[model samples]
Target: MAQFYSAKRRVTTRQIITVTVNDLDPFGQGVARHNGKALFIAGALPGEQAEVTVTEDKRNFAQAVVKRRLSDSSERVAPRCRHFGVCGGCQQQHASVELQQQAKSRALARMMGTRDAPREVDEIIADNPWGYRRRARLSLNFHLKSQTLQMGFRKASDKELVNIHQCPVLAPQLEALLEPLRQCLSELKAVRRLGHVELVLADSGPLMVLRHLSPLENGDRQKLEQFSQTTGVALFLAPDSETLEAPGNVAPWYHSDGLRLSFSPRDFIQVNDAVNQQMVARAIDWLDIQPTDRVLDLFCGMGNFTLPLAKRAASVVGVEGVAALVAKGEYNARHNSLKNVTFFHENLEEDVTRHPWAALGFDKILLDPARAGAPGVMQHVINLAPQRVVYVSCNPTTLARDSEALLSAGYQIRRLAMLDMFPHTGHLESMALFERI
Candidate 1:
């Protein structure tokens, strides 16, 4: 065992230390303590002893990389993807899914003040851990010396790209096209001009969007179109950042609660479709919507929750920051023949209490804010004084910070669940139901 000692930053000297990991943080880093400071070790797990080298030293905590894992935890498992360590897409693949969820729940419990308290995660919503990603964005790089094209995810914590031959996490329909798509892009005359590619598996069919820096040659266009026809993948080209051109009329849409929502290629749809469906259902159930209840949904995108809530409530008002999405939400309401739901475009970061929709009393409120969280809107939400509020968050840190206002306003947590939206990854998504006390 190595000695525990504090040292100043050195230019050449190296020090190795042995530490016993006591716990796993929510982001999957192993937690250890030495000399009254926490040490976060990478590639280590709870109940494991690791020989590690401190990479960065700070006052409260230190970061280290394991030189050798002296002991392994029972939760450790072989990763399915060959590029597991190299690719930055996933962090917790070495740990079992059950362990991952447990760590996440513990972290969430601590964040929500339910760890040693009465409130705890009521349920953990999860699905097939592998092959669940319905959408993916792949980076492209053209090597000058080899005269070849490399396509895949980025390297872990680095800008270099890892050439992926296969990805097990992608939906089977989209994963099957990886090799063929790579071959097709390599053969294109404008291969050097390719920027990146995005693959999405919709209920209707698979769709591909090629981001190219320069105009494609006529022959290259024909080749892409041919590839699309052969593979039955709808093809779209992005000549610039803002525009998307489809060779064929392709309107991609996915099924949610028996409603059809049409979306453009670049729209923000849930990466895990199965979890999204279950999440929507659970959100509705936890809200306990009644026929007489009028609900307000903040940060609503294309009626994912708005239209679904409309099914249970008397009226649902959807507010979105993006005008395009608000327009699409209205279109989807009309498409679904849902007359009670209305969509309004408003900047949620500002004071929205003065908005016309804000004036009307709502029995229930639901918010699905982005990673930044609803900074300026949380207090406003408290002012509305709805009977129930369900907050769906992608970032737990922000969720905890924003929950202060609601908790202070006498809103007690009625239910909480951990949404395993992205498995084998450090991203934690959760939902909390708060009822006025």
Candidate 2:
């Protein structure tokens, strides 16, 4: 057994200590107590003995990094990616996929105040834990010293970019483009001007968006086109545009559940395709739509759920904050020949309860808000008097905070489960069904 030391032993900065991890933080860092205060260590797993060197000391807690693992947790496993520990993109890769899912569920339950409150994980919607990411935004760093380009995700604990030759988490097709991209860019006369790259596996095929700080020379442009042709991946250029949509003809889309959702490359879409299908099916099933029921979908980006929900309900209305996404949603509804769906552009965070759609009153409502959450929009939902509300959350903290408002408004949580939308990462996406008490 590794020796343990109590924090009362005159803790000091830069001190080395051995501690057994008790739990994991939401970010997947190990948590332990010392001298009646909590300490966090990265790369440490619960039930493992971590030899750590303290990096930061505060009145209540400390932050440390594991210098060595004296004993490993049974649930821990080898991460598949070479960049697992260094890349900030993934945190829970060191743990088994099963353990990762369980931890996420526990975190969600605790955050929602339903910990040990008797709600079972009716179904854990998940898919392949590796090679599932279809979209990735890579950092571009040109190393003049080596006269080479470094493209990858940022480092785990800092903004420094980690050069990656290959990534296992990205879709195989997208993953194949990394080396080719680096090689082709190295041949360019103006490689140093490159800023960032966004890769998306569009319905048509793989699409790569090359962001450059300045205009590309004709020779460099030809090289990019050659690279795209060689890889069979569509190449789009971004002139330092933040939205990342280069003016061109590619309208990327994805088909699922008898609907085709089209959106800009920069728009938000669920990463795990297999799990996303399951999530959509589960959401619709939980809503229990009736032919006469009116359904309202908030934050409807490109009609991911609205189109499918429209197929079953008498009428479905989708409201989105982004006008571009609203337009895309309308186009998707029209393209899919789905007649019962109507999309409106509205900022749900604002005082839009008076929106015309609210006057119609919905039988059920679905909310798929961003990490910032719906932001006190339950009042509007209550006023609409929807018999049921299904919330799909990407962040538990925000969901938990909003649950308070929902509970106060007389809503009862009927079902809750965590969706492993992002496996091998600490990111948790949850779905909950609430019925009026």
Candidate 3:
């Protein structure tokens, strides 16, 4: 028999080091240098000295958590939410809103200039820094130790939920329901069966969607209904992920560009209504739509932009990947009595020129692609050679990557604006204008 020697597992000790922060990155992490390697410290701002513990050790960069800040930046301000640092809902709450906007503006400029494109960020669109969030999702977990249901958002960098009693970022109406909602859930007989809760404020009022893994008892159902009736919140229950049941048969709707648009609870809508309205206005202004110009709107979600553009242009064609939104768009167009706009359901990831709608000449084009950006459609846009193009992007990195194709095709970036769609968060939304030279 051969004897093999097994070495004992070595325990790596965490290193605590003091570093001087140099700058803030786009993701709201403080950048520092240690031992010739880049160090990223969380909860630390620029122009601050912090003692940090390294959490991740990489070849070129290390990630650390701030143990304490020996010095603070003048831009630092007290966060409004008590759960600011722990909750994953926000990242820049410690920094002043002005500082956060400035950091974002600088980061946006750098991302756009990566391909040697224009470095100027033309405008920054912002609104009230607090109480602007019209939507939020709360996590639910049954704690065995305490024998209670925990309702809150997930902790930063952890799967555990933070018991949020008050969230300042939520709209005033939604935030007011936090305590009552938690109390009501605690009394439910099927509390353990609850998965999560989604709160959304439509133009009509605030609506609640309760997700449950199992069927609720009769008493529990009555309790939920009573809670809804008492609070005046439209309540819907989800027995499964895909199924939603509204006892009152309520239809949620919102207004945009003076048009009332009805949407399902799970449908996509902007969280910040004020900023969304402004964004739509700016996009139209940049496109410079004329009455005789035929416009093409890609990834047009439920005619959010298509209908608005239709009000100005001769003909507006809205293309969406989701068939449901296409139907909704058509319904909204009819609802708004705008016959000039047409909605089509098509997958934008493939060659779109084969579609009959693509064959039609469009003088101006606007696209609001998701985080993946418009990968397969950029070349087609270039091929069409529209007189003007407007791109609304949620991710700056992808926007920069996709802009290269447009720049190579003799489309000059005429304007760029940083949209503060989500305040106190690292989300960077932007709008750009490009004109054929």
For each candidate, C-alpha RMSD in Å? 4.0, 5.2, 2.6
lDDT of each: 0.92, 0.85, 0.92
For model 3, the local distance difference test gives 0.92
> 154-208, model 2: which lDDT tens digit per residue?
9977999999877888999889888878888878887788888889997778988
lDDT of 1 by residue, 175-201 (tens): 899999999999988888899999999
Off by over 4 Å in 1: 1-10, 114-119
Distance (Å) between predicted and true CA of 161, model 1? 0.6
- State the TM-score for model 3: 0.95
What candidate 3 gets wrong by more than 4 Å, as runs, is 1-9, 115-118
> If ranked by TM-score, best first, what sequence of candidates would result?
1, 3, 2
Clashing pairs in 1: none
